[model samples]
Target: MATGLDANGAELFTLELARFNGQVVLRSVLRDANGLAERSAWFAIDPAQTAIEFAWQAAGTDAANGYLRLAVGSAFQVSGDRREPARLSGLRVLQQQGVAWVSLIGTGN
Candidate 1:
């Protein structure tokens, strides 16, 4: 299981694994200490990289849409492509997000 916090440091959501239709499923909902809001579709979980990637898409639609999002920690590294690996220090976004005290937790190693 994992937890997300908003800009105000409020509990934003919780991501967990559950049994759905006799299969293990991962899901996320916008319900924390505040209250219940909406549920975001859980896409993929990369345990090896300690990352959970998701997308907000319409049902019955299998298209490349929404954000290519990721939440990871120190041991995890973001890349540009399959062949070329990207260095976080080389990216302006990471510099803006700040890597001072990051906590990355997931089911993966």
Candidate 2:
């Protein structure tokens, strides 16, 4: 079970990612119940701009978890994988109080 929370509320998403082989760039959208735009951002692992925060779960040698990519924005599943560019999923916005908080989800298929 994966856990996540933004300025909004708590939510669940794919956090544990496995090593892959080739590039798995995403080119479609499956489900984005929570819009993640204007909130979160994608970053590289191992290292990147301190300003950009990469989840420890997204660390390692996996390409998908390597370099920082793009903000998940309104689009959830776009194009991103471990080995080869695959499909990136699990992105949404957790609402709380009277504000739509930021989104921080994983990309797992």
TM-score of each: 0.34, 0.20
Question: What is the C-alpha local distance difference test score of candidate 2?
Answer: 0.29
Ten-residue region with minimum lDDT total, candidate 1? 84-93
Q: Pick the candidate with the highest TM-score.
A: 1
- Candidate 1 similarity to native, TM-score: 0.34
lDDT per residue as tens, model 1, 39-63: 6554333455554453222112333
Residue ranges of candidate 1 with Cα displaced over 4 Å: 31-34, 40-51, 54-109
C-alpha lDDT of all candidate models, in order: 0.36, 0.29
Clashes of 2: 19
RMSD (CA, angstroms), candidate 1: 13.2
Residue 44 alpha-carbon offset, candidate 2, angstroms: 14
